[model samples]
Target chain A: MSHFTETEIAYMQEQKLGRLATVDAKGNPHVVPVGFRYNSELDTIDVGGYNMGKSKKFRDAGRHGRAAFVIDDVLLPSQPRGIEIRGRSEAIQQGGKEILQNENVDAEFIRITPTHIISWGIDTHPYHPSSRKISS
Target chain B: MSHFTETEIAYMQEQKLGRLATVDAKGNPHVVPVGFRYNSELDTIDVGGYNMGKSKKFRDAGRHGRAAFVIDDVLLPSQPRGIEIRGRSEAIQQGGKEILQNENVDAEFIRITPTHIISWGIDTHPYHPSSRKISS
Candidate 1:
């Protein structure tokens, strides 16, 4: 079974960019906006960017094994909405092209296996629980 | 002198939202999209949200004193642009109304004093340095 609910999947599909946060060995945090996709087969969030292998975030993910990814945008006139995914991340080489599907893109990527998720303002049911802890 | 350059200040003025990354006591990373503005007087990035004081991010900032804030947007079709600021953070009370100008907003906010900055695609001069470490 997919870790993402249908509404969450739909929200991810509509978004094109997410901010990925990783902590370096020194315990300093870093954040950057990147292209990401929901990998159905792996049930993970895959992030790809230019020169992914050389990026600080990639190294941080490999060293720390923890990451947080957020996709959010404000609706007109002050309504903010988005999702926050916090979980385990793996830095993988030769996997970026599969997610990005661009010939010139790098083959390295960061895959996130979500252990917790918090979302708001995108659900059809207004009173639904907005935060969840995933056991997978 | 301001930590932000003229170009960086201008770019920040054009954007309203930023993603803030903070680390918990357990060394886990958390990120969330936030409403932020460049506080000219304080020379800091001020983040405000609903129930700000009760949010985990607020507590995280209070505990860690370190945070990373990134303001970025894709210029459509594939051009990504943004500025990332990493530095000291303080969770302040009764400051949200000052930055947000909303009476209904909680009186809590996070203030960031940037010690490092990185920017790309937002500068008028292409050959200019894209990253800097501030001594302030």
Candidate 2:
């Protein structure tokens, strides 16, 4: 069961930006800002505005066909809640009018269908707000 | 040749944390927070505190090794500089002493060997810092 349901996906769609991470051939990690859209019907997410081989990172994704996306800090540290979506890539043309339709982006689009969805809340004993007094 | 150098790697390692992106089985994108350390000698980076199989997303990494790590919110936006490490993950167990030493964490460690490295920045054409300037 996922902590985030269709309702949660709709809520996150409002905040379109998140941190994206990918690795090049040398095992180094590359991260950047990306704009995303949640397709509630497909239960899928699409990310647009990526340039072709703009960096080795994107090139690696083109070559390897996998990447990770994270959205954090929106939830409190003690009760951090976020989503992780993992998937492969298929490169389409970057000049299409459909790609440019997104008001929040500047590059082409890549759609992701998560095979595994991991969503968790910090339920650690100490950080529970009810367990700790804020003012004191 | 890449723009990121040893000094920048050192600077990034000293920072508290970074965002990491990984792929799920269905080629969906997942992003999360990852605290990592850079190994200068082998030119590799290490990320601990992430568990595979224990969580669905991390388990997805086992099936697909592709990933991206990002650290941002620096002084610059268009030309923001960050280090990206990309590679595979090797699961290993360290002694209790090595695992329990971190001030805030208590768990095993996972080593990620990056195969590629890159330095990323943006063009400043549209990012005019003075655009919002007010006449005093």
Candidate 3:
């Protein structure tokens, strides 16, 4: 069974960009916009970038092994909707091509196995968020 | 002089939402989509939301006193442009109404005083990022 609900998966599919947050060695959080995809086979959120191997976020994910990813957008005038995934992250080499599929993409990426999820304005009421924990 | 360049400030003014990343007591990172504005007077990033006082992100900002914020969007075909601000953060009370100007807004908010900044595709070449540190 997939860890994500149908509505969550659909929402992820509709979005092309997300903000990835990783913690540095000093515990300061860093966030940047990146290209991401939902890997149904692994049930993970895979993040890829142009030069992923040398990126600070890639290094941070490798060192800390944890991250938070958010995909959100406004609907029409004022409706805000999105998903937040906090999970175990792994910086993997030679996987960027598979995830991003861009000719200029590097061969490195970050994979997040979600442990907690909070989503709003998709499957539930616009302002009411639904959260759950996935026990590994 | 302002910490943000004119181009950066203009870009911020054009956007109404950003993703805020905050660290918890356990060093776990949490990110959520939020409504934010560039405060010219204090030269800070002020984040406001509905029921802001009780949100986990508000509490996280209070406990960690550090955060990362990102505002990004894709332009037509494929250009991605945005700014990332990492710095000291504070959870403030009785200020949300002034910041958000919404009747439903709570009287609490998070304020970020930027210490580091990274921006791409705004003033510089597309995909080429410029970064700097702000000395207090």
Cα lDDT tens digits for candidate 3, A28-124: 9999988899998999999997888999999999999899999988898878889999999999998788677676878999999999999989998
Candidate achieving the largest TM-score: 3
Cα error, residue A45 of model 2, in Å, equals: 1.6
Off by over 4 Å in 1: A124-129, B124-129
The CAPRI quality class of candidate 1 comes to high
Better of 1 and 3 by TM-score: 3
Model 3 reproduced share of reference interface contacts: 0.86
| lDDT sort, best first | 3, 1, 2
Q: What is the TM-score of chain B in candidate 2?
A: 0.64
Candidate 2, residues A73-122, lDDT tens digits: the string is 44545446565555555444363225435554445555555555454442
Global fold similarity of model 1 (TM-score): 0.94
CAPRI-style quality class for the chain A–B interface of candidate 2:
acceptable
Every model: Cα RMSD to truth: 2.0, 10.6, 1.1
Ranking by TM-score: 3, 1, 2
Question: How many clashes show up per model?
Answer: 1, 46, 0
- Report the error of model 1 at residue A96, Å: 1.2
The TM-scores of all predictions, comma-separated, are 0.94, 0.59, 0.97
